[model samples]
Target: MSFYHTPKALSAFDAKFEAQKIAFGPISFQVAHCLLKFEVLATIDQAGEQGLSIAQLAQTNVLNEYALGVLLDMGLSMGLVWLNGDAYVLDKTGYFLLHDDMAAINLNFVQDVCYQGLFQLDKALVAGKPSGLAVFGDWQTIYPALKDLPAEAKASWFAFDHYYSDHAFPQILPLVFAHSPKHLVDIGGNTGKWALSCCEFNPEVEVTLMDFPGQLAVAKDNATKHGFAERIHTFATDLLDESRPFVEGADTYWMSQFLDCFSQEQILSILQRTAQAMTPNSQLFIVETFWDRQPSAASAYCVNATSLYFTAMANGNSRMYHSKDLIKLLHQAGLYVDEDTDNLGLGHTLLRCKRKP
Candidate 1:
């Protein structure tokens, strides 16, 4: 006999499918802004026993309460806040979102930067160029606009720097330091976050961070704050320019989250230049995300979304390049892969290679 569903079972399945379809529609900005605005308010709420009134919240320096009430109403609907008559209070989600001590506090970076950048995703894909560059002229424009902002705003961006380092260092550093390298170079190192982490992990390692002038200034300050001023040095350089400096005799080179920012040809040129700077025994460690041997649905979805966002905002693209692809690139640059590690948490992978001896 044929296996056919009963009419009642088929109706129930169809109903569930329709419900899911409705639930999965695009997330509205009204809803998104509610979550973000709640974070700022929740932070204020925790500072004192009594939460600020709506009028007080509106006039607060961190945020304008009148503009924020629109969001607060939405938050109430989302169960992120509780309304005791006219008094508004934070709920469980609000407290967790406002917790600054957690590494995940960096979620605001996504809401503030990525969300706005991705708003023009459809136009970006059709034009086949970065909307951010086209809209704002260059990557540097965004920095100056944000440079003078409050510390909270600055911290949002810095949190991303911290997040990247926290996820990448643990897996890659142990293997690199095992060789007892004396000096290392971090190309395009932003704010020296990764370099500081490296120095913290291996006290013997001295680091040279190379980046743009503005980024170097920030990195210098960060290095000082982290007590790595003497050990970590900053220099302004363009990795893409022919005049780029490669500190000769360095034992290791780190290119974390750098390669994906360029085209294939550009990456090849960068790798070649880096190889020329390395001694025969020198090593290179690359920390990035790539597809798993068998990727799950969630992983694939994340990769696709990130690739699209990067392309739109920065004219950059991320791919899950296999070990063979990396080896081929290294070989073209006259280097060889010595070790490889995958699934380094936070969707990162590490490739350790050495200059051809």
Candidate 2:
């Protein structure tokens, strides 16, 4: 929070340069992607201290001198490559773009799932609907349509979704199971990853997954494959359907990387129903990547930019939330944060809530 409150970090000249970067962000993004796709960055990286010239890149890689020249010229401006005596060397930014797992996953997700759709962000904002979803198909939201998405897009989406939470699960298991819950209800349990983890963590805990039928089907299959079929059960329903009551009285309920998919009103409605179902002893844990809670400016930037994916591709009304807003919603729903843990798994925050006594 203090980071945001301080005076501007950049000088006026540097600020103007930064603004230009934003203005040309789309072009820079595609140019960077192209460099990766054509192995231009990789070739330069392999050259080490010697570096590679346009003619050398042309001779070595499939691309001609003209193609390498244009891409590498843009890369120079983008700080992805540095020019030294007519030879191009890979820069730190280029190294990360080529080898960083997080960068690769996010790049794929943006390109395959959200890039084309993002063009319609303005319309989605005005219409209060995922107007950009038309690029894929006619769907109210991206959740149910996940099963039908193109192979690359679906892969990227799931990879991006799981990467953050997967690291947190090991750390969270100890906290969640400290009290020894008998029954754990995984709300918005996509593909039963958490439920499966819970089962493996505690041999005796009964895990029930609650999600859309399509997602539950995949989760059920995974459970069966892992031979945890008996321990992990599925409860399929649309959580946003206010008339439908949630499965009640679980000892612990978990919503991981789930709530951000919804608008504020919908989140409140879901939380209210969840509170209705919780007993006095019941605990609810929410795992999310709250932008305000991020540790660094880079992580914060990533979280903030992800909000547009919701606006254009996911649901059109939800964005990555501030922690304060979520805490307020919990209070409204008769729940209060009993414990808040930050810096878990890729800048995620885990909030443990209990019914207000």
In terms of lDDT, the best-performing candidate is 2
Q: All candidates: CA RMSD in angstroms? A: 7.3, 1.1
Q: Which lDDT tens digits does candidate 1 get at residues 226-245?
A: 88899999778877797767
lDDT of 2 by residue, 1-357 (tens): 556887777899999998999999999999988899899998899999789999988987787889888889999998899988999999999999999989988998899999999999999999989888899899999887888999989999989888888888999899888879899899999899998898899999999888888889999999999999999999989888888778799999999998999989999999999999999999999999999999998999899999999999998999999999999999999999999999988888989999999
Alpha carbon lDDT of residue 190, candidate 2? 82
Q: Look at candidate 2 and give me any clashing residue pairs.
A: none
Estimated TM-score for each candidate: 0.69, 0.98
Best by TM-score: 2
Each model's C-alpha lDDT? 0.67, 0.91
Candidate 2 local lDDT, residue 22? 94
